[model samples]
Target: MKNLVFNKLEPGTNIPYELLLLADETVEAINQYIFDCAVYLLNDGLQNIAVMALHPNSNTELEIKNIAVIESYRSQGIGSILMGKAKEIAKENSCTILTVGTSDTGFQQIRFYEKNGFVKKGIRKDFFTDNYPFPIYENGLQMRDMIILSHDLSE
Candidate 1:
């Protein structure tokens, strides 16, 4: 990851909709929170390799609304680095908890979050079906619920 830079996306700049859409399903869903969240990009000097969008849910809680590493960069520990950066940002903002939600069908994602110190907290039943306009599937399973996970920053 030499020459990689992690920085906040400048205000008034065009949003990286394609990158963000990797984690989120639709532009409308991203637009709902993108403006309210702080978006960060991980650039490898020449191009962007990852993105994370965080929102301050409360004074003590920070939520990761979206996070994605370019497909070619998967399994290279880049996602973990982004998770670490998310924790740092959460702590810097006086947050005690860092939370993220993913589709229950995303088995790899669930394991990834757990490996990063986040524990299963709760689930929003039918979250995908309720929020998304179309069906979402992963690993041949329909995505119906959102599995919420949390990492205690105070730890």
Candidate 2:
């Protein structure tokens, strides 16, 4: 936990993108949005431990494109730390809503986001089946739809 610095990764800076691929399964999918999104990194002075991708969907909304923490760092409050920063950044950027979309199979993620104040907004039908080239599965369940969650940044 020492020297754990978290901040937005500036453009043209050397960033270890492999850390992002950990959360998002495909390079193609990530590449489609990487440049358009803002990359925030969590590092311990020596190595990368977590990453969160945020993108502006509109003047009043920001979308969490992806969030991932290394296995060894998971459940150690790093993710929550990133969420805390995300909310702050959203407010600073004048965005009123923060949203993230996860697959229907993401029970743990749903709980985590809900615990952090996000509420279910809507669902994107066949999102996984249409987007991912290969079948996506988790916990022995096939991921079919994308459940979108939103948090009001107006507070």
Candidate 3:
């Protein structure tokens, strides 16, 4: 973890737009949080490898708006690092729960969150079809619902 450096990106400044698009498909989708939410960029000193966007939903909860690691740098424990950082931040802010929503078809993402201590709580049906202008696909399956997962920060 010490090898990874995290920085809170400043608004109205340089944001890795291309890197963000890797996690969220549409520019319109990213526009929902890119400007207002807090964006954290993780770099390995050599390159900007990952980014996570956080949105504080309430005094006791926060949502992971977006979390993505570069294609080549994935599966290398980077996403976990970002998650840990998010947990730490939630604790500091006195938030009790950290939540994330992903496509129902995102099997890898579901596994990833569960492995990191998050549990499935609820789901939003037709989230993708209703939000995006076009259909979204993952693993050859058309994404239709959003699976909501949460972890207790107090634990």
Best by TM-score: 1
Query: In angstroms, how far off is 99's CA in candidate 3?
Result: 0.3
Tens-place lDDT digits, model 2, residues 53-134:
9999999999999999999889998989989989999999999999999989999999999999999999999999998999
Q: On TM-score, who's better, 1 or 3?
A: 1
C-alpha lDDT of all candidate models, in order: 0.95, 0.91, 0.91
Question: Tens digit of lDDT per residue, candidate 1, span 13-123?
Answer: 889998999999889999999999999999998889999999999999999999999998899999999999999999899999999999999999999999999999999
Candidate 1 local Cα displacement, residue 144, angstroms: 0.3
Which runs of model 1 end up more than 4 angstroms from their true locations?
none
Every model's TM-score: 0.98, 0.96, 0.96
lDDT of 3 by residue, 1-155 (tens): 46778999987777678888988988789988877678999998898899999999999998998999999888989999999999999999999999999999999999999999999999999999999989888999999999999998787
Clashing pairs in 1: none
CA deviation > 4 Å runs, candidate 3: none
lDDT of 2: 0.91
Candidate 3 residue 121 Cα shift, in angstroms, is 1.0
